[model samples]
Target: LLAAAERGDYAEYGGTSVTWAEMEAYFAQTTGFRRPLPWEPGEAADQIAGNIAWAEMNLDAAFEAARTTGWLDLDQYHQQRRLLIHQQLLRTAAFEMPAISTEEARAHYEAHLEDYALPFQFWMRHIFLSCYETHRVEEGETPTSIAEAIAGDRAAALEIRAMNHRRLVSGWDVPVDEIDERVGPLPAGFRLLVPGGPDRRAEVRARLAEIRESIHSEADFIAAARQFSEVEVRNRGEEIGPLPQRGEEFLPELEEIGRTLPIGEVSDIVETKHGFQLAMVTRRTGDQHRPFEDVRESIVSALRRERRNELMLDWMRGLLQGRGIAVDDVSSAEFAAADASSERVVARLQGEDPITLGELRANWEGLNAAQRARYAERPEEYLLAHLLFERTDVLDEIAEEESSAWMAPLLHIYDLVTVAEPFISHQIAEAAAQITEEDLLAQYGASPERYRQPARVSYDEIALRADPPSASPEEGVPDPTEMLMDQLAESLGSVNSLGAFRRVLAEYAIDLRAVTASPERSSQFRDVPLEAVPIEVRAHLASAEPNTVIGPFANQRLVRALWLISRTDDYLPPFEEMRSRVSLDVQAQRRSTLNTQWRSEALERERFELVRPDPLPAPSEATEP
Candidate 1:
């Protein structure tokens, strides 16, 4: 039944014919896939047949409606149908494309050897220590004031310990636990590294550094990784290879180290988000071409696709040559200058009538705005391309070949859509035309709250540095925050305007720069939304009036000064101002209703039956043909 649908006249109505050839062509054109052949009977073929059947039925219905609506007699409708058929024929011809041979595939592979070259591979072992450890609170545990303070102190001490450990590992002679004692004490407001306190990451990193210093061979490194590395693969000697130059499994830091690290030599301490790591390249392979046998099938498939594309291009070129559509012969400037209505001859076809400027203009006008804009500068090229496409005779000649059978269904589908689209669009437009100003007004009145705009406020802010003082102050030096606060208190009294405030900050040697290189800690924001205001500063902003300068308000991290710019109260816009929005909403609602009604009616008018193919034989039971 599928073969019958593809090879001969399957359906006809209202003086319109739908053959298997046309259907296949339509299918190929629309889907970019050939319909399944008769010998390859399966679910795919059954689905294609059902789809083509439905399309043929609809095309027949469209033809009937065109006649009933007097659109059949319209020359414009006939011209569109002719153009659609020409496109369908071209698609059908594409199915007759030649296949790529094994020899051709081999030749392509030989010509593009560099394209198949593999990236460098590294066989490596890594020892990693995680920075963070999860801690769960006991069920009955409660935080007391002192306990909370102690916890905070412990966190700060741990951070200092980690830093000291890093310093000690990087050739600093000071002991990690005795940094404050030996280095003349930490400056004011700085936390001291806890003596003998547990900082597992710092301890692990120090150990890893020691291992790097001691390891003289790959065996020793592997032994240390198996003993101390946190990763589960440490049991397998912490081996992670043959890793490509870059892949998901390969850590970016590890890849960077592996790229240059000599084989059998351990890498320096490599810091990563997870923890500190020490990587050693056990073995390495340079870039190499993949053997042809391994990649032969892929090459063949690629060559076949390329060959098909070339054949299609050649077929299109033949059409252009056959029809005297010399696009280059027509001057773009002259075409642009010519009046749209002028009957000037642009190109003369071989036996057919000469293409007129007026005809080209008519076709150009028929295109949508985007298409017109795309061809605006080269209208002659666009006009000639469409003119060449108008030659259905060439398409028919190409489509007649038996090899084009697979594209017939696709061609039929394209034809159905092209024919039905205008009618559907007309119906939808007619449905929408029923919507009136009264309907729009009713929609707006029904959903007035939906149009209410939320109250919004905009302000300018200066964000103070969130970083701790880069270095702790020496003895007799005041803390940086305390000093800045003291300066601000004395200067803020006379600072009324933003300019005055900026001058005070400048006098204090505070410049507008990113704090810790983060945009979130940027020095200033202008016209920032009220909703986006930091929670810490929102209360102050709520009570402040426009044009008022407020703050030097201190949070845990940042001190902010704000200039309240403006605020607007929430309100619904007037109906007159929102009429356009209401109309669009009503149109969308009407379009949905019209589309549902159209589809429902189409379903009622068309009777579609899906024919399921017989199940395929089991591989064991199947016989060779």
Candidate 2:
């Protein structure tokens, strides 16, 4: 009664003189279908067919009223119907997206805190000096100590290089064919005439001297290197770093010094298994922890993705349940995954129809790789785990109905909605593509900090390890830290270049063997992060600049001196460079937030209901309302 009052159809019974011709014309105009006319020579239906003619008359009356008094202009009515169908389709996606709160995101972060920890990395540069160079000993001067022996060897090496320089510069104008014979076959790792080789050692030494002098006078090592060093890094101000902890590749002697080296200071020459080395500790960093602000965005995005999947699953379950779709737990049926084409029964559902392996396989191609994988990567087994709706032809089913004359017009309307619904995905793409260059830029602006690259430095280190004074702790030896410091200071005072540092180590009685004379960890430590082990070292590295000498720092029984090689600060690129990423992020964020609100409001307007099939019979088995 309420439904009749709502439609205002209670008064249609007045007069009641409607004829077959009138009803036939009305059905033709409204449903686009007509039956035999009263005066036409059509085959007369038997008495049984006449029994249902009144039913068509009643429904035709409804469609006619809707077309006229409902004031639906035929073309305008179809356009509006199409619009309504599209909106219904978009709502499905809109409901699936969900928004997460800050509190929720933070809770997730705390749970996964360890995942964000970055390793301890150090960006350092060093000048290496090998300890094995043969030095010239004075006639009748028997070496008394290790220092003397080393000094004699160092002097001899320098003298030989000086001779080589003289020959290369003025005297030995010998052709390439005679060069090796004259120099006694250039030593290993050496090539005559080529730059920074044996024949050019003297010039290399001289240039290093000039660079050292400039550094002592407070000139930048990177700047000096850009003007003087011979290695490939000279193009980059002689810097290398962003190195993490290392072993054999790094000289044992320079390790501690690199950790404690100041940000940008050049140090006096340091020596290793090789010869004299000039070093500058350009940069040092500790363990890295991405900032919470940057991490927050990612957490939110991840949570939303999870939320979307969960919501989609829940909605699909509800949709199916509403249509009396469910696996019949009582059935012993199972799909033969091994032979999917056999159309074997997988499970009986609440509906009388049982789901088959072939029916499930039909939709397999539409699933993504991950989705397909969920089915054990097999159509047969996958069907066991998932509940999916099989698509059907509503129009075909209606056409085949014995009651088609009565329900066909209503079915036409229903078919129109179902067919037009698929266009929604295209509509959604068009809507999403509304993202513009300006939108991407705006997105980038919102999370400018998230895009910043980690701080990195190209630096060189000068490591010098000094021995403790005493032989044994049982004998009341001096404090090892103190002894190591004194040794470093005394050596530091006498050295300015790699050559000078070797000479000083020889003078101070510091055994060349006791030092890790090679670049502490090679010439460059590549891209070391800012946070890591050894807090004192990290603090010193964070504060210094190019050419800065930070240490003489003492640790355990060893002492070290630091030099700065080079530094590279963290920075972000422009919006245009990362446009695609920015647009995706922006759209995702807006989708989540907007959909959160849209769903909450729209659900109030949604009309949904479920009818249990176990107790109620199919619609066709029951009478109409």
Candidate 3:
């Protein structure tokens, strides 16, 4: 069979013929390398021939099964293959496009000069002090007002602290590295040190004014940034740019500063909701046209692609015109209203079968949701395109004459795979069914680690709505949520038992059941995997003893208090408990073993030996030009 397939005379498997081209195509698909030619000295050709013969045998068996059982639709399979072949032919024709000349490329460039115009850009750098940290809301939860108020307070404090640090750093004459030494190391919770300073915005402006007096040049400004910048600008030696002067890319105030500031000049402090910022423009460029030579190759490639698309569209139009199919008169609304099973003729070629509404509906339904939505948006155009593609006879003829040699073998393999899949699955299922209980036990005993379960925790939790404060607190007035949290914490501190904790929760009008239930309406988690728990919750639960009340841990949306009910370390379940899982494992092991045995038998029956080729030599260093 191998020799016949290689000789290009093999004709069996319900009149399906195999050729050397098909063998080469199969070899490339499997090995990712072209098979050696007849005259080439290698064992690869023999190996590829063996694979081809095996595939053909399987295809033949599948074909016989289909014929005997009348289970497969050969006509549908052939139609799908014809569509693939037509696509391959079109791709081949498109890639073999006519060469585009430099003159043509230049003309296109001249006509679309705006496409190559470079925007006004500049180089600038600044120290950034982010007053507020961005927070990610938990799934199925909305941000609460209390959380926003807390964040706002924290941001206000941070702005004050950042301004103080800026003031301290600006007064120093030491180098960027030594400035830290001059200020001394910061203690833990150092950021909260200047929480209630003078108006933060006024302080920020005053600090910037002092810094401006000391910064005579761009280098001086950079040194000041290195000393006081909250972000990582200190470590970077070069300024970031030529960034486009686009409003969306940068803060509006920063973009305006970058656009209007003279080179090597610093701007006044610009206030934003996040924080105060000062920018210095280091370099600038005016809007300019890209030189034709710089983008010539790209322009040529673009023109080539455009030309190819036009050619393909024209070819499709000609095919439709030749068949006397006029899709322009077809309305999407008509098709939309028609039943999918309706047998009304939508279009047809003279002397050919009419394209039915049912056929069009079936084809449309085959597309995925995204593709269906795209086509539905312009159904008339889609109809025309589909009609053109539906001309399978023309497609097959063109593909036979123009498609690459590899396309035939690829199509054959695709058909064989689709047909043989069910038979292969049935065979594997039969092999798996032979697995016994004893086999499952032996496999389970051999792989004890696979049966071990990870540690899990069972807990009950109470949740509260910690919405942001609706109004800002006046001077010296505590936030409403903060006061509530304080009272709850004080109340929980005196509760020593689970019953007492439950009483306290009830007193607070908190319902644990309503807060923790999942969207599926399932009860709160029990025996959930430790790794699956949220990191913050996991930290507290990791070492907590049973019956311990923990949390009041608040996120941007909720305050959660958890009571640990039980916990278990990683352990293996009893054999009876894991019987179903072990049985599945045994069956999978058997299936894999059978597949290996079959492949080995095929190799032995054919007397074929695989030979790996020698590795190519590495390239030597090139001599200097």
Give the root-mean-square deviation of each candidate in angstroms: 16.4, 25.6, 14.2
Model 1, range 266-299, lDDT digits (tens) per residue?
7889976456888888777668889999999899
What TM-score does each of the candidates earn?
0.46, 0.30, 0.59
Error of 1 at 153 (Å): 49
User: Pairs clashing in candidate 3?
Assistant: 144-467, 144-468, 145-467, 145-468, 145-469, 146-467, 146-468
The candidate that wins on TM-score is 3
Question: Which tens-of-lDDT digit does each residue in 1-625 have in candidate 2?
Answer: 2222222211112222223333343344344555533332122311112212222233344446446765235576556554434323323333746888999998998888887776555565544422233333333322122133433332333333333362223234544443334444232323111112343345445556665776752246655554344343333354566564455377644656676656566665654433455666666655666667789999999999777755654564454556665532212134323334655565566636777666665666677978756654233324433554233222233234423454444334342222222222233344666777778877789898877766555444444433333145677766545655666676577444544433332233332233212212213354576553156566677778755555678555435565555656678977777777788787777666654454334322332111111332446846677
Overall local distance difference test of candidate 1: 0.60
- Ranking the candidates on lDDT from highest down gives 3, 1, 2
lDDT of 3 by residue, 18-50 (tens): 455665555554556655443332355554555
Give the range where candidate 3 is weakest over 10 consecutive residues by summed lDDT. Answer: 513-522
